[model samples]
Target: MSITSRITGSKHTFDSVREVLAKANEEKSGDQLAGIAADSEAERIAAKDALGSLSLETLRESPVVPYEDDEVTRVIQDGVDEAAYDRLKDWTVSELREFLVDEQTREPEIARIRPGLTSEMVAAVAKLMSNMDLIQAASKMQVTARCNNTIGAEGTLSFRLQPNDPSDDVENIRHSIREGLSYGVGDAVIGINPVEDNAERTKRLLDVTKEFIETWDVPTQNCVLSHLTTQMEAVRQGGSADLLFQSLAGTEAGNEGFGIDVDLLDEAYEFGKEHCTASGPNIMYFETGQGSELSSDAHAGVDQVTLEARCYGLAKRYDPFLVNTVVGFIGPEYLYDGRQVIRAGLEDVFMGKLTGIPMGIDACYTNHIQADQNDIENLAVLLTAAGSNYFITVPMGDDTMLNYQSNSYHDASALWDIFDMGPAPEFETWLESMELMEDGRLTAHAGDPTRFLEGDR
Candidate 1:
């Protein structure tokens, strides 16, 4: 009936029993005895419940804590005076359209509210504007130029040469690079996520890539998509890389899981900036996306989109040369379908560009999703028309290594041709020298010269 008797099956007091156990064995045995006593107490409580001797208290929910507003929210709230915002909100849709067309009236207000505007509001406003007006608005939002100034300068295009082989064989990777460059890709950056992630392999890949860059004299950079720590290790071991790369999340724990903290990131950035051989705005490359916060269990009650924007703020602090939002790579639990994916992709680009970060879209989808290459094309075209910085073009627009399909090298060429756009300045000059471009048009050297139809080819 007593606690000590219930646990130890002996007629000893609890304190005496604990002291005896501790003396006989060690402090650990005493702790075990304490656990037995606690279990016995729990059983007694359950016995009382069986006898209907327990009283119940009414349950009350805790107060909900409000999210701490971010700088973008605070800035927008401050810039749009309450009275003006209310009046503007009440204006007829047509009146809003006309106001948006007038640069003097629209730019100031739009810039203020743009950070906080919902996707629906953006879509509604976009529906009323002409193509030219949309392009102009996107241009006004540009803060940082990226990818050798071609992206923000002249709607430049580029792709990722993901030699995702497990061995990371030098010959295979070299062939892929040759093929991509032969078609005028890599203007943005020829980045690879090496299958075997280690300092030696990454260094080998970078060395081979540098050799190709030098051999071909292409005006582009090479990146091995490894963790920032691994990249730093490679650099320290005398491995050459043009850019340091990592996938970053919004929260500290999430970043720490990837072996990076803000201080580590700053160190990597400084090292790349000092050692970079490529011609670009900056030397650090970062990849981020929505759902990563939730996936990493670091969302902290903030919406995914807002958390993603905060990541951009973190990335901006380092002045990265490239910040790509791999919009749908995490799949449908966060985005659900193609419609959500498209909207999120647009919203990410808009937010990233507005925040003064060099932005690119890894307009991609997993096989398990309802999206496909067509969905990517739709987002890519819309973003391109809205002055997106760059895109990741894989072989045939399908990533054999990552097992997903994205925009292809041909897709980049098509967007250029349809919009009459060209590559970045330095890249364009290189392409002209290689005869990939002539008279502002992508020559046969830029794509399939036979121009075969889909089935015919």
Candidate 2:
């Protein structure tokens, strides 16, 4: 059905919920590139106005991608709690927006209705929300998960030690991990993106990192961010890894481009449960971003925000331990600049939390984006305030392998200090034992990698 809005005597008509969603989204270069963005500011606001007035029932009825054709649509539609959906089916998106931001409506109330809302409904509200609105609403919610240790507990901010080397040098990665651990990093998994996707390389990387964790009895897990298939093959060959890592997309076609689908993900989840080294449940690690569908020609004429929310829906199926958006890594073509990158970082984290997934942000930008370290640092501080579960930290804010700038290992401590936060509880105890941190602050012995070296210490 068509939705139209008249604002200040100018009329704008959107062809479908898909059209309205794309137009209502905050300025994104990806949408513009797809020729789906609103042509003018008034048009954008009009679309938002139209969208806010859409009932949750309408959104539920109108799957952005049809159920018959898309596994993702089926996952979202089939997962809703019918009773909760019935209770809130008639509410307008704007009312849901108010409920999310209202001081009286805490996470419990929100959580109760969370199962009723679809990804489109979530994206619709986000389009109507201001930047602060996103942060304030998200801060009220805390979603925690466990693999090796708990993540997303209150008053804690964790970091993933992304000790990636340009080459798949096991020793080089080991050095970076030592340095990061010295700074009280790696509270989250020590995840490495390997230089190659071969099973042999993945196995070797996992072996080196897992050995270090065992030797030091570190309180975190180890993950080699290879394709799930490669990681599984390595583990089948007797390699050690605490988590299974994979990139996810919103649509089945988009996922297909990455050589994955719901079936493969389900198989991987079951495999991790049976064979992954982490204790108990929650062993999957997923990475997503806004513009992946469009970049891969699988967007189906939908907006990036809507596509992004669907990714969370898919992720929720696995109850993943860690899910982060490589928010600005997609380049200027999708996020465009610092402003867009910051907005997307906030939106992704907020949406993930609302979905009840332990969410975090790789608040980063590529070298070519109109953003710098300062912009990413600004995003990191905002994400911490927004109660993010964890963040991806590279040595010195530069990922030599990925060719991007993210938060530095040093940045995590700075954030904890600024916000009176500490690392994950178990990790904090480890840090104190290692003399890397004391009283929620880095100690004198912190930042000294030599302390971890064999006999040289």
Candidate 3:
């Protein structure tokens, strides 16, 4: 059905809910590249006006991709809490945004209404929110999860120690992990993105990371960021892993490009649950970004923001311990510059937390993108202030293997110091025991990898 909005006597009509959602988005290069973004800012505002008036029921009834045709839509529609939806379905998208940002809307209230919301609704509310609006609304809903230790606890921020080697060399990767640990990072997970995506290489990476964690008694988990199938094979072959990692997309076709389907994901999740070495529950790790669906040509004419929210909706089904958007890594085609990247980062985290999963950010950029370290650093600070569960920190903000710049190992400690936050409780205790950190600040020996050598403990 066509929806029309009149602003200042100018009437703007969108042909479908899909058109309204796409046009309402803040300027994004990917949407424009897809030939779906609004042509003018006035039209964009008009689309927002129409979207804000669209009832939750309308959005629910209007799946971006028909349920019969797409598993992603089927999963989202089937997963809704019918009882909760029944209560809030009549409310307009404007009301939903108000409910989320209302001063009285606490975590429990948000949780109560979350099941009623769909990815489109989440994206709708996000579109109407300002950057700080997104931050304020998300700060109220701190969804914590646990694998080895608790993450997303209030007054705490965690960092994933990404010790990726360009050549998939175990010893070099091991030393990078040590360096990150010495600086009091890696409380979230010591994850590696392997140069080789095969099972043997994945197994080797997992084994090396697990051995280091055991040797140092680090209160964290280990994951090799290879394909889920590869990781499953690694685990089956007796390579230890605490978490299974995969990159997810918003659509079934996008997932196909990634060589994954819901069934394969479910099988891998079950396998990780039964065989992986982590503690109780929350064993899956997922990475998403704004334009993955578009990159795979599976966006279904929807805006990147909405498709991104659907990714979180899919992730919620597995109860993942960690889910992060590699926000700026996709490059300028989807998120043109610093402003767009920052906006997407905030929007993704807000949507992820609103979906009731642990959320983090890999505030990163590629060399070809019109962004730099300063932009990524700015994003890290904003996300940290927004109470993100974690951040991805590679050594010195550069991943030679991935050829991108992310937040640095030193950036994590700097943020902790700036924001008066510490690592996960269990990890902080371990850090104190090792004298790497004291009184929530890095100690003198904090940056030395050699401190962990030769049974220094």
Candidate 4:
């Protein structure tokens, strides 16, 4: 190969290494060839190949980029009367929710629920937020809850009946919860889980959840149906979700917990046909522990098998456009062993394949590892490669607050940056080194336990 040395203020190409070496030698250069410039073609070619490989890895990690920037904006603008996002910029959760609900109510097909807040209401506001994107929040919105008490332990808060019945006094309760939650900081997904035994009771529970959800003057895109209904085969088969919506469009709750025995596949399909509205929100999510420890109840051990089954069932039941599921890790325990963490995640993928539901993850943890740039990027690459489309974690920067922290405000920008590399130097390093693992798993740099990855399946 030819190497060339560039003269001052000159661009030159070297075809022969020897010639460049001879010139350098004459210049009394040290034993090493100091001032020579090699053709960058080789490096360029290597980088190209490397980036191509990394792109494939990223794709494998997150397959669903459903709301592209333009698409999100277009849908929002077209569907919601094109309220200049600029005018509604920096609005809080409640403000944004209100904007979308108001816009959605204009559509004759969708109903609106500008329900006033009340103490008895358990609010479950469904939202799809993004950065620098047009969000079609003006679509259908629905919130569902099961007042039956089968979900929680016998003595737990959810197991006991709350002061108000969601069905009998939903409107006032919902108003109270909405007002109360908006006063606090944290995303509100409030819903009641009443203890109910049989299908009839379960149906009654769902009916209560539905009745409360339907009272607002505004339209609901879809109800955030709790996993309680997901447990009822009868409810799953009974057209509960469709029956709940003006548009019959919304999610069927179940991907989060395993207790619900409803054949997700059968129920989702039937629900889709009878009540699933074209514009309703549709996605389910399940849990994975950060510590790698499974709970004794329905959520034990981040059961990939159960997760996969649920995913497969959902996919079989609904078209890609109608149904989606997210599998997530919630505790620090799942992070205890990077390898195990990935294994649990892959099981989720296996479930997704079996059932055919698009998957995402909501990374929630009580104690997250504090990381430097390299550590953060490395973790991102590894986790993404292991089949995580969405990562909901603590934000980076000076903000001391964390998500799900007791009354702490989560920085929207930090959450946005979790998986987004932006233009960081270490991010490039992590991207380039994504495939390098000791046991086919990524690990944090020496002395950094916060970062990790997978080694083998």
lDDT against the true structure, per candidate, is 0.61, 0.92, 0.92, 0.27
lDDT of 4 by residue, 1-457 (tens): 3333233444444333222221211111111122221234343232222222221112122211122422211221222222332332233323433444455343232222221111000011111112101113311222122111011111111101111233434454344333322221011122232333345544554454445334421122223333434433435555243322111111122222343322543455455545543233342223322111133232221122222332333233333322212222343332333333333333343223222233333322233522233333333344343333233222221113222221111222233244332111222233234322223222233222112211211
Please identify model 3 stretches exceeding 4 Å from their true place. Answer: 455-457
Worst 10 residues of 2 by lDDT: 448-457
User: How many angstroms is residue 77 displaced in model 1 relative to the true structure, after the best TM-score fit?
Assistant: 15
- In order of appearance, the predictions have TM-scores of 0.70, 0.99, 0.99, 0.31
Ranking by lDDT: 2, 3, 1, 4
Q: Which lDDT value does model 4 have at 451? A: 23
lDDT of 1 by residue, 1-457 (tens): 1123222343433232112212221111112322322234443333222212111100000000111323322222333335434444544334544555667753356556444332223323433344456555665565445533345564555455455554677776766676676566787787888887899888888888777777667677888998777877887887878888988876665676566776787777777777766555588888998777666665544345545665676676777888889977877767666876776777677657655667888999998877887899998888887767788887777777788878877676778888888777778888788777777677776664222122322
**Model 2 whole-model lDDT (C-alpha atoms):** 0.92
Clash pairs, candidate 2, are: none
Candidate 2 per-residue lDDT over residues 1-457, each given as its tens digit: 9899999998898889999999999999999999999999999999999999999999999989999999999999999889999999999999999999999989889889988878888888999999999999999998988888998899999999999999887788889998999989898899999889989999999999999999898988999998999999999999998999999999999999999999999999999999999894889999999999999999998889999999999999999999999888988889999999999999998888888789998999998899988899999999999999999999998999988889999997799989999999999999898888888899999889988896643
Better of 1 and 3 by lDDT: 3
Q: What would the per-residue lDDT of candidate 3 be over residues 1-457, giving only the tens digit for each residue?
A: 9899999899999999999999999999999999999999999999999999999999999988788988888888889999999999999999998988899999999989888888988988899999999999988998999999999999999999999888988788878988899888998999999888899999888888888889888889999998999999988899999999999999999999999999999898889889989994899999999999999898888889999999998998899999999887878999989899999999999999999889998999998888888999899888888889999999998999998999889887889988999999999999998988888888998999998885765
| TM-score quality measure for candidate 3 | 0.99
